[model samples]
Target: MSSKDYYPMETKGSPKSYSPHKNGNLMDKSSSEQTEKFLPVIEPGLDSLNKNPEDVDFIPVDHTPPDRYRLVFFIMVVHGIGILMPWNMLINAKQYFEEYKLGKNETEVVELKGKFMFYLGIFSQVPNFVMSGINTFCQCGGQASPRRIIISISIMIVVFITTVILAMVDSSDWSVEFFWITMMTAVILNMATGVYQNSTFGLAAILPMKYTNAIVLGTNFSGVFIAVINIICIISAPDPRTQAIYYFVCAIAVLLIAFDAYFLLPLTKFYQHHRAMVRRQQNTSGPSRSFQETCALFGQVLKKIWVQALCVWFIFFVTLTIFPGIWSNVTKKDFPIENKYWTAIFCFLSFNVFAFLGNIVSEWKKIPGPRFVWIPVLLRGLFIPFFLFCRFEVENKVRTFPILIDNDYVYIVGGVLLAFTSGYYSSLTMMYGPKLVEPEVAGIAGMIMAFCLVMGITTGVNFSLAVASMAIQ
Candidate 1:
């Protein structure tokens, strides 16, 4: 509901300053002094808000029709995929990068590449972290925030243009100048990636928890699809150059599909209905969050669900640090998989599929609520060192760690547990966090969650790069 629900609000201020249609258009507004009026701040608790079940425009997940549910799920997953596809390309194309782009020898290339790529990846996360961190303030309201939708579509345009440029470029002719230019393009692509990713999470926050889950699931799905493509291209292509070309072509195609899905999402009946209901509800009250008030709202949200907030950060941090960052470097030359970072792709696939499965399993089972959520999630830290040691790394100048768990099966098992816990627990936290307060503040909770999620990911990338840069050699 819009601030109108709190309508007939007896504010002490003389003027107010919020006006925007749900479609993301700007409306003429009075002077900013209107916000100076004394409005009662929001208190915690659904009872405090004086809102009823029917008052909320969107259907509750349990009551929603199966068809609409599926549609929401599909859009979330597709957008999720698009948001992280750039990361996927960077991770899976390690072989191409290691061979053509990096150091002279296998040892130097593998060790240094992980650190370099992680550094680059984290640079991209800055925008995602910054934009999502203050999403509630940036958004006008849950329904009428046209800025988020416009930002989402605009980023798509930039990313799409970048993809086309990449596809048309012939890297074989690249020099030092051209290579750095390519890197600059990557930076822009990743920066745009962060903007949309956070926008999506913010958008989903305004919807039900299931839609959020769907978007998170889409990220892992993107990873799996990218891994599969990596495997197929490696097997089918004549050389690394061909594989690189295939990667670019397929990236453009996948991005196009993701954009189409996002474009169609608003046209669906369920989306329109939900939006209209939110708009209608707000007619009773005008949007009234000011800069200071927005900050206070964020603080309120953080205080309520800090546990879930921390867990979400740790989950991604651990997962992000280990899987490809360290995995890309460690290779047993004598091992059966006689390829560079092939094991990394395998590990990537394993984690994505298992994580997706865990998200699905959450439909029926949610063990150890907030009480024990932190414990198991904390234990996941072991995965970083475990997955690290499992790979072939230099023990010293002359020798390497014994390849004890060289079998693919062992990595597969590790991936399953890691991913399952990551997906299930993370989903549970997000699904429950928003419900802790009034529905009006749910979007704020979601924005915070997205911030924490990206923060964890950004930190994880840093840890992987910093630590592995020292140890991998």
Candidate 2:
């Protein structure tokens, strides 16, 4: 009954324990089961012997199912487009909102034109930031799910439909009221967008890194898609109401496609397999954590990815601060193009096209990894001044600062650089985010990165107000 009685210490390394049939003794040959029973239990990592599978410090063989025909990738991209369609549509329809909708009367036009872009930025991104943070917490608690994505998309659809209806009614008589109504819609649409965006990021995080980048690609592409449409509208010269209708219709169509694509995800073996893996890990890790526990997990994940997360935030912060708020209003200076197309081409079209290209480039290769990614991202702050001094046509506000970069080509180049870096680094940071943490909490990391993204935009937009004021005063 002694510890060494069954197997003496000398037998620990004995060949008999491994193969009693050694030396070809047929009578002494041990059966496979007998040999297996005597074989020593190899403890790879004694500390992990009692720990959960997820707690083990090792990468499991990736048994993830192949994304058939890249269906899952396309779905994430569609969700990306869907989540941003409302905002992009509204932003691209700058003329409609500023000129026709809010510019009905000269007084209202004067009062609103200078302030509308800032208002739009504030209304849209503030709610987006708040909701994304709240949604991230919900994700930690397991309350955020695909169902929330469905509900969020549905709410956005309804909001777009309402916008379309309002577009037809001609609220020119009530421009001020219409302005407030439009801002209200922006708030509502983006609230849903926050949840939708955060959930989509979390969902995509469950898959490969490229899948999450697909969402970033789709977001940038959404802008490109709308910008192309806007260009066409400008050339074709559609009436404001008709053009507004066209923009919302395209947005709704994209949303519908994304909504349809979402259902297909669960049916796919690839998606189901990933979902199962996550669920299994969660179960094996013991029941879901309490609120405090979830918060602790969130902090842990944030600590792991805070650098990349902040990179994601600052990237957007720099982008939003100068983009439509400052860039959209920029003109060709003393070398005016004799048409109103300069801002559209040099600003909207250029930024979107190059940004989309940047996303594609990021997908092709990640430069500098996560640690040094913040370097290029931080250097992007120079773009704020580059755009600030560009020719802006803010009504009634005189430029207090001299135009440092007077040439249109330099300005265009800056726009392209700023936009491309935004897309490229945004993609890099986001893709780096979930990967920086443990696999079980990758989804939470994705949500946190998403919140950081919104936080950046919110901060950038608010900061833009001061920047704009300083530029004009």
Candidate 3:
């Protein structure tokens, strides 16, 4: 039939055409009998995209330029860097901040170094808790534009300027207020990291599962990148102030690259084709469902897939609670050779590297990461005690808990496991969560998973103080 003469088989309630599944889906009835005109099982509201269900706009798998797998990977890596790099650089570049912003001379900074480290840990997580709620609202309201990158870039530029100022000025000569302003600006930018991260994951969710994997991998890459920079600077840089400047210059440059990637992403044929189709339907199909409608749309799917949500949350919760915050405090030099800041940065690097491996490892192992993951997630709490025993409050080095491992190698091993399992299982949870429902709401499922992961980060950050306290005790 011509387009104008079409009866559009997608219409519901034709008794002869469809067999209603107990779930809300409808399947073609006649396939079993013979040559039947039955349509494939799909979500009820999804038919609005096409008057005929048979011609669903498939987002052709085009791994070309802009939307190429590597480009997607790069964008996500930049996205990941945006999420964690600011906070980490600030916290890890502790000596520089202490001397420059806090107005401590080298002698005083050395004397109170442990206190600074401890406080930076606490300061970083505070924003994670605050931003999660704001992000949920941002996601639900929907970003009509790529404002996430805009906000991030603008904030980052201001932060970059402040860092340059802090780098050049003598802290003692500069007003204490200026130093506080700089410190607060970094914290604020780090706090706002999730805004862009949430937007990045949401964009990736609308793409294929491989794209989603790319986003996750990118995040780990951020950690690895920051760790490497800090390690190199610690070993090579003569002045702490210069090291801080290097970190800021790199961070600012990275923000520009992320903006470029974000800008280029939509130009790809892969992105263009999908987006054009979606936009066309949205224009002709009346207003899309409200956030409440979406919530209701996938409420049942979410119930069935609660484990996926929990796994996402717990994996991150376990990670945030122990890593960077508590883990960075453990002192270590080069494994066999003594090197400055190698212990903290290396531990951080181990987590990110292993996590990246875990994400990719899914290709070889046919392991369903979501299955039986909660058990190990529950056991991860035990990592706190193990890592605590290896940590010291002493200015030089001293183990607090002597019950188990006193060796730095123990910390390295524990960090590896912590990073690896987190990467592996979180990847699996995200991959499988979208399959819990019909393909139409698969995007919603993925978005929900990302939201829960953000929630997990917030929860972990909030729990960090308690975990840190209990670990030290």
Best by TM-score: 2
TM agreement with the true structure for every prediction? 0.77, 0.85, 0.77
Please write out the lDDT profile of model 2 over residues 296-389, one tens digit for every residue. Answer: 5577678879999889889999999997898887877565565567777777888888999999998878998888998989999988887877
Total backbone clashes of model 3?
Answer: 0
Q: For model 3, what is the error of residue 39's alpha carbon versus the real structure, in angstroms, after optimal superposition?
A: 19
Which candidate number maximizes lDDT?
A: 2
RMSD of each: 9.3, 11.3, 6.7
What's the lDDT for candidate 1? 0.63
TM-score of 2: 0.85
Per-residue lDDT over 1-473 for candidate 1, one digit per residue giving the tens place of the 0 to 100 score: 46434433344543322233323322223343442211222222222343453443332222222435578679878888887887787667766665565534455444554355565666656655665555535665442243444455456556545655654565544434434554566566666666666667765765777888888878878888888888888778847666766776677677777767766766565554444334333443355645665565567668878988899999989987876666655554354665644565556677777887888887678777776788888888988867666664532322234445676567657767988888888788777776665444566677677778888887888788766655544
lDDT of each: 0.63, 0.78, 0.62
Off by over 4 Å in 2: 1-62, 140-143, 334-338
Q: How close is candidate 3 to the true structure, as a TM-score?
A: 0.77
